[model samples]
Target: MDVTGLIPDFGNLAFTIVAFVVALSIIVFIHEYGHYIVGRWTGIKADVFSIGIGPVLLKRMDKHGTQWQIAAFPVGGYVKFRGDANAASAGVDEGAIAGLTPEERRATMPGAPVWARALTVAAGPVFNFVLSVIIFFGMAYYQGIATDPLTVKQMAPISGVENTLEPGDEILSIAGLPTPELAEFGAYVETLPDESPLDYTVLRDGAEVTVTTLHPYPAFVGSVTPQTAAADAGLERGDLILAVNGARTATFEDLRAFVGAGDGEPLTLTINRGGEEMDVELTPRRMDLPLPDGGFETRWLIGIGGGLIFEPATRAPSVGEAFTGGVEHVRYIITSSLSGLWHMITGAISSCNLRGPIGIAETSGAAASQGVPDFIWFIAVLSTAVGLLNLFPIPVLDGGHLVFHAYEAVVGRPPSDRAMRVLLAAGLAVVLAIMVLGITNDLFCP
Candidate 1:
């Protein structure tokens, strides 16, 4: 056996496990704390608040008589309220509540008002959403929004192209075409001719000047999506695509056209990274991309985003603007997630899109390897997904518990203990089946 060959694989596995645990632990803590705090506020006492399941590794008693603990497994967490049957809070602990007085009974989860119980169960998903919003808001505030008029902040170096644009130069026109508003620049770029060394008219030092430079939208790699062909091929930011299978690529549109034409065939990409050239072979992946007008389009993509030849100058956005952007980001994720799930269910998209624990761990490792900013962004995205998933109306989940609460509210009593047990068991089976399907896809899907 060649033991040395397995060393790199083992190291990568370890890194992925650590990254996955770290990300999952943070999200789970936030979710479980939401239940704990809200339960406390509603006069329901949480007997145990554990960040993980299985045998306890660390434990502490808080002043409120709640035992805060960390367990062996780091996969998930839960809050066990007073007089609950178990961590899932499926039913009341009849033996524990048998001797309690009226005042003490009010502290148990089952003894609380229907509204209080509902709020406590609903808080977990709500907190996950709040964490995502906070992360998005902080990122937006830190990055700042692009300034209007598309002024150049810094030029990205391209190996074989001459860049005459300078910082603070407000772009006025490109190749004799008047520049459009910043919001319309992307669509405007598509209308430009696919050629390099174009005429760039800019406002330099309060005077209009004409300079020759590479096309505004060149074959430059701005970002790479994790767990995709480009990332797997070791593509990095700022790498310029010089050619595709001996065909020259001057603009990003040319590169896109080449990839789209490939139809998932393997291509030889001539790349320029920091003045050095190399060849990379990768096959484009077929993807179902969501469109702006609430539909999806199929495309072959290598999973890299292109950008202009220079970084645009930016301005600090107002607090309200940043917060609004954060909210919109969350909303978009929620909507797109729902749409994707529906498409998968309806056979409009591939079921392979449903990723399991392994897929998420791989993505976690990839994101961490990219850098802290990318890792944080991945966490925000995963948090949104986690929040959305928990809201599904399935048993053994927060949403299922909310439904039970609703039933109790209308019937003036909770479901029978036997019926509750059966429904919860059925929900557990549905959840496990989904998990199995996801894992199967992770193992078998491309």
Candidate 2:
């Protein structure tokens, strides 16, 4: 068999692996560091703090006696506390504990108070969440929020349409309909006529002037989601959807309407990329989208986001506002994730939504290929998911350890060693089973 054709596929796979490793390593380091720092603060000594699993590739002993190391595997990491039998901290090292004095024993994880143990176990996920929040806050602050009065900052190029609106022009009305506040601009635009070359009344040079321009919301692509139908079809930002299956499309809504009406059938999209026309075919995927009111709606989607024809002027928001927005964004992701999981469980949505390592790696590569900002955003999102996953109350996870701590708190003792072993084994099985299911979906699902 000729092997030359496989070289490109191999190179792509390598890039995907590198991107996945980089993202996972950053998240794993932060999570493991959280456990290490909090355990130290609570007087629990760590024997080894490792990033990745398997044989150690590099190691260093700190003044505090913690062995900091990097291992061969780049998938996951852990902190082994004093008196821990293994990386998971499943049980005490009885011989090690017996050799230590009472004072030294107190510094061991098995010797620490239940409260301290619980706090250390919980810190990993909490730190992951904090990392996501910081990233979101920085991004929001850097990008700035859209300014009020809806002034045009810059005009976007549209194929076959002339734009007369200039930067610094404050839009007052479109097609004789008054423009609403910046928050309501989206809804306001939907109310406007779908026809192009609409009359725009704007305040320019301290004077109100009327000019003709394309519809504020045209069939323009502002963003394309990774691993979706559009991305699979090689769609990119700034590609205008001129027509759908030979039918002319005027606005983004027109494109959406056509896709919605297609009922998951293949679509022939006539695209205008930089004035060059081309046609591409793709089938719309059925997606369960989360709404603002904490519910979901199933819709046929191509996974491209649309925006107005002009970039809106923006103002730097106060730190408080930016932080609040960041927190809200994180909350939204968490709620949406939980809702999606629940829907999958209830058979309300496709189980294929549970992506495996392969899907995530592919997504990481796609996001990295887009640009640094998109890659960083993807890392933050993946970090949140990782943190949330570790918090599930399944054995062998941080949540399972927390649950055991809770039981100790109530029963005035930890579970029996045999019981602990049995529970840990069961938890590991559940985690492995989940991994298998995700991989199966990745391989077999459409």
Candidate 3:
């Protein structure tokens, strides 16, 4: 390991903080705007429209008597009804607009017609979903989707890979795993050992053929940065990271998270190049990466990108199928996200992939650097995730509120206040549990 690497420059922490705040604020605004516009349409008086939590930062009163303000906790914001003590804590008046008659209170939230109330609550999440679709279509109409072709990008002169799996052969599946796209196929290939035999089924000239071949990964035999320790383990270009310790890997991110704080000793890697899975070992070297507080912390670096090369940078999606591709891309991503969450629960997928605001901020900065097309794509992905997450059946969220509204519609009236309180409590617990799990995943995985 070269121990003489230079320090990392996050460039500036203030810039990152500002960027994160802006991104989150925009998302929140769109989400809340959806509810506000719909509520107004339903003739419900919104007494307060707040950005953030805790205390008020700034305030302005509209002609409708609604006070629009930015709050102290900037992380969350809400809309308060005429009679609401708070948005989530509606119906319980501790002194705010107390002593009003049922008619007056009805002007508030509790007295509103059931359908009106439900629609108002549903607008927040609906807005989120709309925002996602917009982002998806916009990004797609701008940058064309990535297409995975059946043709070979490279071939081995002596090993005869072209002989086994010819160019223009449409990939069907690996073993039983379906290869729907190039990204999925890439994951499958990366999961294989560098030179190990892999079963691949492809459609070529109206014929299906199964072939065995090797997948190559780049190893760091050398590094300009002293901290990339993957080089020290005798790993070099053409070596693949098939498995970590004993766990199978399918993506670059997986390999990274799985190997964080990597045992500190010589860790083994399975690499395949010319139809062979070879065992290699290496120790990581530590170097500093930029942190949030205008400082740096030492972390391990591998000094290598990966196998199955990245395509050259492109500008935008094609004029023809860009929108179609974009929509399909968003749909597929949303479905995979739900499945991924389910798998996390079942232990088939690791929860370490759950990223909080901190992680999102870091990624946002990276996407920005990549260019507008990539950044827009990132927004679409994240917006879709946030939209789905809000739809989870947990109280304190729009989805949970929708469930209550649905039940009230079925049973003829709203749930009891006590019941609502209990449900909110339960919902709060679920939120906390998810937060704890995500934080734990971050702390332990790396």
User: Which stretches of model 2 miss by more than 4 angstroms?
Assistant: 1-8, 157-164, 207-211
Judge candidate 2 against the unseen true structure and give its global Cα lDDT, from 0 to 1.
0.89
Q: Per-prediction count of colliding residue pairs?
A: 0, 0, 13
- Candidate 3 lDDT, tens digit per residue, 209-321? 88765432223121122114553344544445567676665445556665565745556666554557777666654433433343334555555555432221234665456
TM-score of 1: 0.95
Per-residue lDDT for 1-446 in model 1, tens only? 34233223888889888999999999999999999999999999999999989999999999999999999999999999999999999877899899899999999998899999999999999999999999999998788889788899888766655458989999999988899989999988877788886898999999999988888888889888876789878889889998999999989989999999998999999999988999999999988898776667889999999888988998888889989988899999999888888999999999888889978988999888888988898899999899889989987999998899999999999888899999999999999998999878777776
What is the lDDT for 247 in model 3? Answer: 67
* Candidate ordering by lDDT (highest first): 2, 1, 3
Assess candidate 1 and give its lDDT.
0.89
lDDT of 3 at 269: 69
Rate residue 12 of model 1 by lDDT. Answer: 84
What are the RMSDs of all candidates, in order? 2.5, 2.5, 11.2
In terms of lDDT, the poorest run of 10 residues in model 2 is 1-10
Q: Scored by CA lDDT, what does every candidate get?
A: 0.89, 0.89, 0.63
